[model samples]
Target: MKNYFIVVEGLDGSGKTTAINTITKILNNNGIKDIILTREPGGTPIAEKLRKLIKYNIKGDEITNKTELLMLYAARVQLIEKVIKPALEKGKWVIGDRHDLSSQAYQSGGRNINQKLITYLSNMVIGKFKPTLTLYLDLPPKIGLKRILSRRKIDRIEKEQLSFFVRTRARYLEIASTDSSIITIDANQNLKQVQHEIYKILNQWLKIYK
Candidate 1:
């Protein structure tokens, strides 16, 4: 059987990292031997380097939407080649922190880039290997922004205004609504409650995978 490709997505600071980590530990404890937790724009060596360059502001030149979109696909290509495909071939669970939906959200919704262009570019780079199960941690844009602000300096994407995040979120919901594979979970709940919801989703997915 092909291994599962599970992608967790949301606006920045939706407790994605914590949820991912908790899922990792839970899967390990459950004796899911071949589970691998990885993320986009930084999974492989080359992609990680590119991630830093794209996210961090340069001294003078700005990272435009087109360049940002291209770089994300570039990283995704390397990740698919070096990490995602190989691991699934070896029959391991690949839990991704983010994936192509992020491109759709940030580049298209936030940056006002063209969706068709982004889709075409992503397909050329990563092909049709979309996520089998996408867990969208849903939280209000204001809440996410506040959480993000408490953590680190704002990157180009992070610095985007409240209006941008709202659109991104609306787009996420719109897409997920039409897709059964993508599951939306409330992220504004407390951390433990959020983790519980995740565990519930994983349990349901495991039934299909098993």
Candidate 2:
């Protein structure tokens, strides 16, 4: 079977996890075989450890943005080699919850790190292995924040000031504008409506693109 790498990206509370679950079930019902759903920063063992460090804000006391970027790449490098690439090689449909694009949006956009440098670093680390398609669940940061707050405990990144999240979300939109592979899906709608839109996109992917 041909390989498919699908990525789902959005700010917190954009319903990414729910979308993935729904997509998985829908795909299975459609008899789409060889699907593997995964998330970044925690796909492999080593990256999961790094994911804990970054999310828990364990290194916050002295963590510079540069260090944060490096640590993220460190986790990414390992995941691409250990999880992503291997799955693709086996002709499995790999669905990523978040990927390098998250780094660009959060680190470069939220932290105001250099974009040229960020691009260089991303290329250096990721090379030609970008996700074939990404579903960008777009919604207002305030709404997203509210959803996140009601759903679960906040992590280090989540504990950041409101200003940071607002900027980060803008960055996600900004990057989505420049990438053809990214399909922006309206996320402000009710859950069923959002799922309907996602289902439409998935149907297109499976029928036309596949």
Candidate 3:
């Protein structure tokens, strides 16, 4: 059995979670049941703790950009090592809600960190391991913000200014443009339309896999 690592990436309220669920269902319907569904920033125990710190200011002080970036990588490496890698070795497919691309968009793009530095960090942590397929759900920050605000309370990262998300989205597009492993989907359409597009992509990919 060939293991697959599938990553779903997008800004908040881009419907990544819903898309992952739908993808999982489709894969299961296809008789791919050895699947591990997870999310970044907190997949493992230690990573979950780091996620809380990163998501909320539990210490009552602002987390500097560098600190936030490092902590995110810390959580990510932990998840990758303790869960994702092992699952893959066991021949289980892993579906990720978010992945390293989020850090590139949010930390390097939104926070104005150097891209080369981020690349170095990524190489150090994840090395040559990359997702088998990445689905990037693209949408405007204005619309995504509206959808999020209406759905739930904003977290620390979500509370950033609209400009932050704009920068992040731009970075996401830039990275996706150069990465052959990434497939960008326009998420501005209706829910059914978006899911249909995702299904189409997955169906094509699975056909090739066979």
Clashes of each: 0, 0, 0
Superposed Cα deviation of residue 119, candidate 1 (Å): 1.6
Q: Tens digits of per-residue lDDT for model 1 on 15-42? A: 8898888777767776776887788789
What lDDT tens digits, residue by residue, belong to model 3 across residues 82-187? 9999999998999999999999999988999999989999999999888999999999999998998898899999989999999999999999999989999999
C-alpha lDDT score of every prediction, in listed order = 0.86, 0.86, 0.93
- The runs of at least 3 residues in candidate 3 whose Cα sits more than 4 Å from the true structure, single-residue gaps closed, are none
lDDT tens digits by residue: candidate 2, 1-210: 467888899998999999998788777877776888788778888888888888876543856789889989999889888888898988787888999999889998899999888899989988877988899999888888898889689887877888887888899988899988999999999999999999888888878666
lDDT of 2: 0.86
Model 1 stretches with alpha carbons more than 4 Å out = none
Top TM-score model: 3
Worst 10 residues of 3 by lDDT: 57-66
Model 2 RMSD vs true structure: 1.4
